[model samples]
Target: MISDLFAKIRRAFGDYAVDKRLLQEAEISKLPGFVAEYLMTEFSMNYPSDWLERLRDFVKRHYFEASEKEYVKHMLVERRKIAIIDELRIWVDLEAGEHRGIIPTIGEVDVRVPADLARKYQMAMITGMWGLIELEYSPDTAKRGPNGELLENPVVVVGFKPFQAPTSDPEILRDARQYFTLDEWLDVLLNTVGYNHSAYQTVEKKLAVLSRLLPIVEENTHLAEFGPKATGKTFIFRNVSRYTRIIVGGMISPAALFYNLRTGIPGEVAVRDAVVFDEISKVRFPNPDEIVAKLKDFMESGQYERGKQRVTSGCSIVMLGNVEVEEREGAYVPVEDFTYILPKPMRDSALIDRIHGVIPGWVLPKIRQARYHLSQGFGIALDYFSEAMHTMRKESLVGEMSKHIEVAGNITIRDERAIKKMMSAFIKILFPNLYFDNRELEIVAEFVVEMRQRVRDWLHKLSPGEFPKDTISVTVRS
Candidate 1:
């Protein structure tokens, strides 16, 4: 059955189909799944039988570990010029009147970038880009200080080739939806993110896993997921999309999340499609009251201001944390109230209300058994898949949603919005062609309402006065 399914996926996606095992076999596990898949697809097409050898060779030659930074630099000095694949971020040094490239692995930040290269890949200046970069070492032209001492690194980025698809059409994904059953499509999505669909036996469990992707596919959809450790809550967010940023437990400042007042630069939220707060329990907000206030404003309107600089971003927010769970009738469930899952700073009712939904993370199985859980079948290349979803975010289905569904219960405006946004996301994920029948719409509506209900329940628990006991329901228009 799995082979047949793989064959079906290959037929449907054609060049986009990728065997996830190749990523591991080629020893590119250090790279992001999307980047590894892109290399696999590119190499296999150009070098069929020997693609594995070519890929392994490329990684060995071009990619370097942090420990090998000195070796790479020495090579550049000896060779004058050398090419490497790395994450390159560019920032303007107005005082110096030039753009500087930051190669994190090599720990070089003052490497000069050509003005033309900076403008050509503007995203590198914003959120950073992973690509093949040619660095030229010329100590003869190194910058000198007022005291006649060297002031900057002699290395400069002379050429770059971004490791990304030149163009992507979400219409291809949308149009291809007609070829698979909804269940098959759900499995396809799971496999694309490096999971075996068979491991999740129930449709509800599958949807629970896919909910991690809501923020990536839909704009400004704030979500939270809490469960026991190793449940794979953060895996998809960290690897599936280059547009997603994950901040592990640490002190978070307004400057890091919003606009940096000192540097006149927009933060992660301004450039990425999604910014995820992982290990939410340990996440700290310095001056909690102030940063949380800014977060509330941004979460509510997608607009923020700092130091007289105002910005608006369509980036979605996601929060993930570990919670205590116990076995209940052969299934794992949370031991404490969901309201206490967040840190004290973010425990306000106003902020909680802004979150669209809370994923029931306990339902997702732990990824302890890799051989059985990891995908071994064909799935779409992550780069192509991520780009497709990024493109799909621009196409809103709320108008189409209202034509077929209605929120018909005691609910606030926020509740209504959350339901519509989540339902629209589900439709975009499952039935992107927008051709689901009434029965199909009802199934999706039921799941969406349940998700929003989790938030409403949390709100009720947090503040009984503001949120009374209420049930959110949806009616499929006949």
Candidate 2:
């Protein structure tokens, strides 16, 4: 029955020409419906097959073609040129003492780029920046590798856009928001994150909203969410945006994350929109104090120094870990000291204070077979929605709070800042184009305050004397 419902939903959205079977073949069907559709739309030619290998063979065979037009015509007919339209993430080959874009599939290819784009492309390669480029494949250096070894294939960059948060127009934003009612918009947003709106209750839907939106809506947003395993905490950062990198369990270094002074290279934080630390409880850092200090500074100020270079970035940091929740009466509640599950260094009061939101992941129900979305409702295509939120990040929605709401006077500046940032992000996510009544604003603001307060409560629990009680509250001033 569920499979039949999913097929019907797929057919309804077939006007977009998405390859639904390709998703199942690629084993990426668990991703959000919109996300799967977006991927298919972009790389439809490659669907249900390893098209990269096919592209490599085409480039190799056509290397000696006399007529460019004839070769391109062949590509057009064969669906080969479509590869150039979809952006691919490739590494710049520095091992050869010359710059070359190395497609993992077409190994050791001589990468060619236009003269005008050389500088920017080179810088991106050196800085560990994700280069989303449309390649012009070539077999020019098929005879020799960069190290004078045998190289069978080479490629060129015909067009490119450095992987960064894309922006959307205000008019488009206004027009898009106008199409959906409040509940419908929420449903769309939830489904965008792979939640079936009809499958969950009202509260779960709301939790899904905050979970999906919190990371995408702003820079320097610090979030920590710990739940039972397989709760899909890593999905958005992993699958939603091209401008995100998820670092799984490892001993992460300040040099790797921020900047490497010896090599004069900027790190992940310098480029990606959101950097998630997955299984953070198990992640070990060599210099805990240095990481904690630098992270604290960066989370607050959005800047960090390595040796002589003071690099700045707007990357949001997300920490995802697994936790064991205990049942209190009938409901599942987080253990009394939730902070104890985190690494000892991360439990610092000052460090905890910097976190904008600490999600109550335990409140979320464990995923079952039926939890997946099979909804008939429409949602923004993943790429468009991601770009819209990226654009919305630049706007100052925090100012809207002053006109309609206020935080308690007892709240510290940091607390207020966290609340305002979280609330503003919620507004951008839930009500883009800044369209919402005072009542709606108040309700969202309260949820934002509560999330922030959870961090505050944890801080006080960890250090009783240093942190104060929960006198702070969010109120609608008008």
Tell me model 2's lDDT, rounded to 2 decimals. 0.63
Candidate 2 TM-score versus the reference: 0.76
Candidate 2 lDDT over 103-220, as tens digits, reads 4333323455444566655544533333334554455434585787646434556666543323345344455566566665676566555556666566544554456567777777
After superposition, which runs of candidate 2 have C-alpha atoms over 4 Å from their true positions? 1-36, 42-167, 370-377
Candidate 1 residue lDDT tens string, 206-309: 88999888898899999989898998988898778888999998999888888877766678898889999999888988889888988899999999888898
Off by over 4 Å in 1: 65-80
Residue 115 miss distance in model 2 (angstroms): 4.9
- Clashing residue pairs in candidate 2 are 110-154
- What lDDT score goes with residue 169 in model 2? 51
Report the error of model 1 at residue 359, Å.
1.0
- Error in Å for residue 380 of model 1: 1.1
TM-score per candidate:
0.95, 0.76
